[model samples]
Target: MFQSTKQTAQTANLTAGGHALPADWLGRIVLIWSGYAVSMFAGNAASYAGIWYATETTGSPLSLALLYVLAFLPMGLLSPFGGVVADKLNRKVIIVVCDALMALTSLALAAWTFIAGPSFAAVALYCAAFGFVSGFRTPAYNATMPLLVPECHLVRINSMDTLLGSISMIAGPALGILLYTSFGLQYVLILGGFGAAAAGVTMLLAVIPRDHGAHEQAGAWASLKEGASTLASQRGLLVLTIGVSLGMLAYGPIDSLMPLMVYDHFGGDGFAASLVAAVMGAGLLVGSVILMAVNPRRKLARIIVVSAFVVGTGALIAGLIPKGGYWAFVVCIGVLAIACAWFNAPLMTLLQKNIPDEKLGRVMGLFTAMNGLAIPAGTALGGLIAEVTGTPLFFQIDGVFILLLAVSIAISKSVRKLDAASSDHPTVEQTL
Candidate 1:
């Protein structure tokens, strides 16, 4: 039987590490997440529109590849510093200011596109700028989670966050196309601006708790090294991070290659590609909902390993689909997306449970930076490979690489030991 909302809230308050939660903590989280979701939806819409613009304008694989590289590279470079700032500053202020900047950026892009007409340069510039700002926002926002929610509800809230992102993925492309075809790119950008503004305002209205202690005593370089040492001190976590980073290096290009796969391999149009993306989003939504309902608190590492195998299998199958098998490809995409959701939620829960609150921002920032670097490198490599062998063959290679990576992780004693202990009561060593 499921506990009622009131009972769940009361239990959460009672078990919150000897700290009593505010009476309306749940409500506050809901309000903040809701606003963030709106921002994500609009931002995604604008992003897709920009992607489509690039696709139609250049029709080159390298252009698509460069888009992701430009978007993520700055964030990758800046995230460590961003993490240090997150640990040392007011997180709420960071989020609000970043959101406001994003809103203004969007509005400015809209105006520029309206005047100069759409260009790849403009899209690239926007991607670069957005990525830069997100470097600061991502670590701060992620670190704030443990402060707001109790340990027991961490998985649920993380799942909910991913679920909301899935929803944005499902709708963003559709809305982007509609607005792009009907009004113009300017309108899409304008909508994104409004959504970002709304997020900032809602965050302003909500009350968020501060970090347990001040981190301003340490210098920036020292703080960064401390965060890095903290992560390295945990053998299992260090191994896990390295493994995931390698996997992402192989898997990251899939996002950039999807439209090309649909167009070049399946002879499909923009709408078909969007349909496939939407199906993938649905798969993510299903996975997140299941995780939210079940709230599994144990064997998180095992879950990630199994999910990786499923994802690899799905990708392999998708790559093997025959021409005129677009629906089959879509089905495979959905399956992999579900597996991805499962993989992500558990990984995040494990980190949140194991890392102390004070250092979480820096650690997450470092993690994000690694991923950010790996993704662009992968995308660039994948683009070069796709140009020679076609997208289908690239997908097969990616899948095989991931499968091997997963097998390696599964056999490793260190990673498997991650699931041996109860995460509810992490030891001092684990937190350090």
Candidate 2:
């Protein structure tokens, strides 16, 4: 089922490590996915455990915010350089090395926790280290997808990736609570270490295709500039990227403020907040399943545009909910989550389909960095706005901003042209 018979001649010519495509490529790709699945679960569990530990140890809101920022800041700062490396080096080697380093870091964190009893400083340090390695790992893994799977299957594969991620999100917290309550943070960290090691080993077992001469002559600065130029050269992609980043900015506050919204506005407690979160997660899972079943191959830009509109409307409605309308708010949150789930797969597929493989890493890296930076910035801004106008009012404003952004994207001729452009199947040498 993973195999695609519709590979164009141009796509079929793509090679892995100077060798022809192997018959067992599907099996190899599945192995890579399996490794990632293990890591995702472990990483999520470790994050939950660490956050709980922090809450118990310091019980400071500022400390929790700092911990969250530390997790994303390094990745935001380092992703561009990591992308340069992904384009220049063997991507498989990058993945393997980063995963191995993460494994070692997790092991070290476990040992430290066992001895030091889970201080705030140690957890913060561990978060920074994990984010640092992930900055490198993410781009390589994203760029490697097209090399392993046929172009026709990109949407399905991307959907599957999101599906697994959603599963990890839903289940990881449960595992973290169980492990933390029963065994402690040390065991959770140990599990994380093993997960990372498993991911590294799977990458080692897989055969990943790479362009041997792509960006080989360019220095890091030159390559970085090229990635930027490549992004700017395509007006549609540039607009799309900006729009997505803005969407993240609008939506990011919801994550930070959801519990508060429940408490302050809806007059609900922690259980209600947790229920809302669980329902939203289920919405994401449902969206992934639908996308996988549909395997949309056309009008991806339209899908994105519509999804943004749905999310904006959902948020606006959510903000308008009265104190007694907790169920209504929960339903809106689910709808928003479903729309948000639709965003990634189509967008990533568009990038993979259009961006030349040689330059995909740097472009993906920059994309990741922008997105990573946007959420925290949005959260900070949202907090300020919420403090002033209140949580519901802030959501109302965020929703309006996003709705306008969606309309602007829909009206843009450049973005509308992306559908036709993606169908052309340009060769890797083509820029933009």
Candidate 3:
């Protein structure tokens, strides 16, 4: 499963080349990270503009629902294949190609919208293409992590990811709104295209190893089956996957409805939505910083379970707040956001450490696919429940359900035994 504390320390002392890491290891990663940050920020900006445009133009729930489906469905459907591609192809090439393709498609959409005027179809098409590429891009990107850094630095690096994402969430939407209002959706789309393209070009400078095992003769179905088997081979990983997948059901509604909750329950305005998001982003940044500094190496299973419980507690408190308690709701959201880093970063590090590099892409792809599917299903279920009961009731029930799930994971002998199962095992090493 995972390396013991001692083994991790031993591995951390060696670089991907089995020699000591250069003094500039952190600097090298930062160089790569800067490119990603720019690209993601621009992508988020485009997405926000599209959503806002659709809301203003169509005002149809059906159209909005379609946009949501398009956003997630491609990833859900194509992730397995993407995972196979990641495992068998040069990951750097895959990343660059995905970024380039996405940029081109976005540019084409911008042209179409500029010529024909904004249409739901154009936005939906862009979202679909972007999502499709992301299915592949995300797996490769994640799989590349172990290649770039020592095992001990995984937590800190992943936390950096969380921190960047938080900054994007806080800044992207506001920037998108401003650009859209001042200029237009076309400009926003062009901005996104350039951003992605720049990232692709910049990524070319990074030196990454090719996948040697990818040449093995295997059909797509065979590759998928192999990936599935790899995941099933590890009981702790299997359980962890299932637990987190189910947990997405609890998260879907919260993600899709958070703005609505603020607007309806707390009598929030447009600024209030941004305010809540900023608070949550700040909380995530703080949590990420703490994890980066602490870099917890022991009792990961316990941390995951406990963080999940904290998340549930935050949700429960949010739901229980009296009407007009805006500040209280914000605090709960902050707590939920902070707990999110704890719940996710550790599990991600564990998977990266334990899984073989060749199989990492497939495993990450499967995880993304499962979680992607769960989100839309959960969103629909949560929406229906909210309609029947209330938003507050939905949050409360989701919290309780998550708490139960966490307790189940905590009490499981398999999960509890994970810590002791940690051993010094030889792992295939690669680098970027």
Candidate 4:
């Protein structure tokens, strides 16, 4: 059932890592999905445990800010190099190595924390290492997806990715808190380490295709330049990149302000804020599930445009709700989260289909760096705006900007033509 007869022996013979394509392609995908899901859960859990420990131990805003900086700084610094490595080297090896490094780093930190008790320095060190590794890991893993799954199912696979990620985010924090409270920070950290190790081992067993005509022999700077050139030359991709970055910037502050919005605007406590956050997560989970099941493979552009509008509208509605309208806020946030799943899944699929596998790592890495920069900048600006005009005003203004961005994308000839163009020039499927 997995390998249809129409996919003849020649296609089946085109192997990943010199091995024949598995008969049960579906089963292989399931295994890969399970491994990554565990890794995501562990990573999120460890992050929460570290942050909670830092907050409880230091109780210093500066220390928390430092923690945040450590979490992101390495990724910003190493992303370009990561992209180069991903394109130049065996992607599967990079994945295994990065995951293993993260596992080892987490384990060492767990031991240190256990021996000396929790310290901000130890946690910071672990975060920095993990972040550095992630810079390399993310693109390699993403680039591997097309190799494992057929293009026809890419949207469904991407939706499932978001679904599992939302589930991990929702459960990871609670698990971290539970483990930390019941056992200790050390145990939580150890759990994260085990999760990473398991993910690495699992992927190690899964075959990935070698790079075809990759710019491996070229100088790193030249390769980087080529990746940049690819993005610059592709009008549709360039438009999508700019639009997504701006959207991230516009919405960045909302991520950090949800709890504040619940508490200050609705006169609610931490528990109530948690409930709102949970509802948003639940919404994402639901949206992902539907996308995965329905697996819409057409009208990708319209979906993206409509979803972006929904996201902006949801944010605007959240801000417009009157004081004490807690349920209204929850509903708005839920819609926003659902729209996010729709916004992200097809967008990722579109990029994957358009970009060549040889350059995907570099493109994704550059994109990640751009997103990283935009989000923090937007977050800082949002904070300043909120301080001056209040959170609701900031949200309202941000919403308008996002809505405008979506309208522009909807009208853009390039964006409207992306999916159809992508389909006409299909990527060569890598079988394993």
Candidate 5:
């Protein structure tokens, strides 16, 4: 389905609307990026606390799990329409509006936590509301990045964003844990409210380029229709998306099962339980930095395919090893970190390069939705698998599934030649 080398040569568009960054544009980018990093820390600070609140108050894993299910479910279910909205509206406007709504939800959740105990239903409602807004925001955020910075600096900017965000993910959970253990869950949630509100307000101040609703825009159904049409036509791009989606599905079992396995198979908890997540995130940041130097487009198939294989193998080995300790666990997780970093940036960049700017949100909406949908099902399936075959056996079985994806892609000509063909084969009107 992908364009051959000869065809891509005709389609390549090296010179789009903007040139490489000048000094002023670089400064503006830094200003916006820094704001986003700070807001992310605050907006997500209460995640661990929310879980702790549900567990401590109700003594129920189901109560805590409710928050997660609510978060992922709406994001996946509503994302297609959300993408349509993004394409139909100004992206900056959509982001600002969504951030504001999230802030309100955060604030309300904090208020409720302070006044009374966390009812499972109340927490689920808050999580779901935030998830809905976030689901909408992701495509807009992805679509906006290339506009905020120059094409030449796209990789650097994306790497920096992922790096900083990964750090925030680690710190936020730890902070929530500490806040809940010492002062209590209510205070931590209040802090989360403030963070979300601040993130929303600062977003209003940042001047982002407008690229949404540029065309008359398609209706909701038409938006998805357009997205599918685009992918259907681009052979390389379609295979790439499917490969990544499958990778996510297979990796989910490891992510869901590993912690449980560590706690039960080995005797690690509290700080140790948290460390597993932190280590993986830390590895992701490190891997992202490494890949910044090694562009995926240069060897797109090898990286995506091999990295996925590594994740699958590492997960199985980690689960199967009889007496491995913290060090082994950390190392195996680091392997996954490598795979994840290798996968993210280029996949989206490839889409951005191939798809028209007017349709980015719509296309990314499908992307966002697929990712959202995959996570919940993967997680649920992992839990179910563990129940049947046991966690250790499930990880090993899932590892085999991940391996199958790599095998599938390696044999497919479209994916194997994607990078080389995309760069050389199409004209892409590169000199626009």
Candidate 6:
């Protein structure tokens, strides 16, 4: 009985990290994820500063919109190559380089905020250049994460990432609001810049173990071709990326217009606008925690199908609700965040699992790229809808498009069969 009990106890101590995961791997995730969390917090705080600083001093709505649009333009254009770099180079080095670059950008923003003040054109130019630099890092990190954790527990680790990011999302905006209100946006901008630099310093200390199985034989162009070809082969991942892109297109407008939503509805104070955004971030935190608790053991394809449906349903419901003003709109968005979290967590897990490590970066790059693929279009759609209708209809129509995309994925048998075998087959996806 004593021996049997000992065996049971040992089994209980073992986590999913034991399978397809290295020994002492969880330690690495904690070490790396902690550094990443701080870095992201400072980075996002700087983002909030950029938006609020531009809006308060310059008061240009277009400048405000430029903040969102310009930030993403880099990712949209360069993400494919970023992924290729992730596969060819050491992922740890890539992450360090990316964080270092962000640190520099943050410092530049701080300088610009103080020295240049708020020039709409200057801020626009600043944002565009910053966006260009960020594109390479996004895919690099996504592909690198699985190197830190095991496969079977991808959901738990992803939920962990979301939880950390949620902390950043909630804190960054709130910090931006508080600093901007009390110390002024200039100080907030400067502080965020320093924080990003500090994060870079922290990231420099992290050591990611090497993957012996990683692809190293090919040159940059040849490696790029191989990664692209693999993604193209995965019909399921391709469909999934496209569906995710639709949801992202719908969601982008929400961030761009939230400040206006707060003013129209919440009382026109910067605090009120920031509070409205914070509620959604808080909901995301809650939702991520919940997902971590109850990871689905079913098919990857099915989880995605259900998640998309839920996202569409939430957007539809939020759109159907009557908007009384800012606070009311925020309340609706908060609920929407829950739905978004549920769908996003599982979809992320699916991508991390099916794609091989060698090509994971570029694949995740393409995956991440899909998030912004329709942004230019979403902006046009949102602007047109806002003019003709209102925010509510904008949400509803985008929700419908998201739902249709999900349905398209569900209907394709080939796409839905990604989990039929446990083989780590090379996969391929394309946007154009």
The candidate scoring highest on TM-score is 1
TM-score of 5: 0.87
Q: At residue 37, give the lDDT of candidate 5.
A: 75
**Local error of candidate 4 at 246, Å?**
1.7
**Tens-digit per-residue lDDT, 31-106, candidate 5:** 6666677767765557655654554465432333345657776888778777777777777778878877876777
TM-score of each: 0.93, 0.87, 0.89, 0.85, 0.87, 0.84
Q: Indicate whether candidate 4 or candidate 5 has the larger TM-score.
A: 5
Q: Rate the local accuracy (lDDT) of all candidates.
A: 0.83, 0.79, 0.78, 0.76, 0.68, 0.65
For candidate 5, the 10 contiguous residues with the lowest summed lDDT are 10-19
Clashes of each: 0, 0, 0, 2, 24, 12
C-alpha positional error of residue 310 in candidate 6 after TM-score superposition, expressed in Å: 3.2
Compute the lDDT for candidate 3: 0.78
Give per-residue CA lDDT, model 3, range 1-432, as digits (tens): 234555656667764324455566676677778888898788877887776666567643344445666777678778888888888888889999999999999899999988998777888898888878878988888887777678767778888888887787778777777888888888889989988997798778776656434665687788888989998988887898889878886887776666667766777754576677767777788788888888876677887888789888988888999887999899889989887877667778878877777778888888878877777677777877877777888889999999999998888888777765653343333121
- Colliding residue pairs in candidate 3: none
Quality of model 4 by C-alpha lDDT: 0.76
lDDT by residue (tens digit), candidate 1, 1-432: 123444544555642323467778799998998898999899888888888888778877889999999888888888898999999999899999999998999899999999998778878887887788888888888888777778788888888877988999899988988898788888999988988998999899999887443846898899899999999988888777877877778777888888878887899887887888788789989999988988888788887888889888887888899889999899899989987888666777778778887888889889878887888888899899988888888899899988998999899898877878755444333333
Candidates 2 and 5: which is better by lDDT? 2
Using lDDT as the measure, the top candidate is: 1
Candidate 4 per-residue lDDT, tens place, 1-432, comes to 225343534444533222345566677777777888898888777776676676457544345545555655567667777788888888889999988998998899999988998777888897788768878887777777777766667888878878887888677767776787788888888988888998988888876667443546898789888888988888987888888888888876777566567656777754565566567778889889988887776667778788889999988888898897888888889889988888777877777767877888888777776666666567667766777787787789888988999999989998878767645532333322
Each model's RMSD to truth, in Å?
4.3, 4.8, 4.3, 4.7, 4.7, 6.2
- Residues 1-432 of candidate 2: C-alpha lDDT, one tens digit per residue: 112333445455543222356677789889999999999888877876676666556544345556656776677778888888998889999999999999999899899989988677777877888879978998888888877777656788888777777777677766776798788888988988998999999999987766543636788889889999999998988888888988987877776577667766887744565566567777888899998888887788888899999999998888898889999998898888888788888988888876787888899999888877777677767777777788888888988988999999999999989877765644333322
**Candidate 2: which pairs clash?**
none
What are the runs in model 2 whose C-alpha is more than 4 Å off? 1-20, 52-64, 181-183, 213-215, 259-275, 322-327, 422-432
* Candidate 4 Cα outliers beyond 4 Å, as residue runs: 1-22, 49-69, 115-126, 211-215, 263-273, 420-432
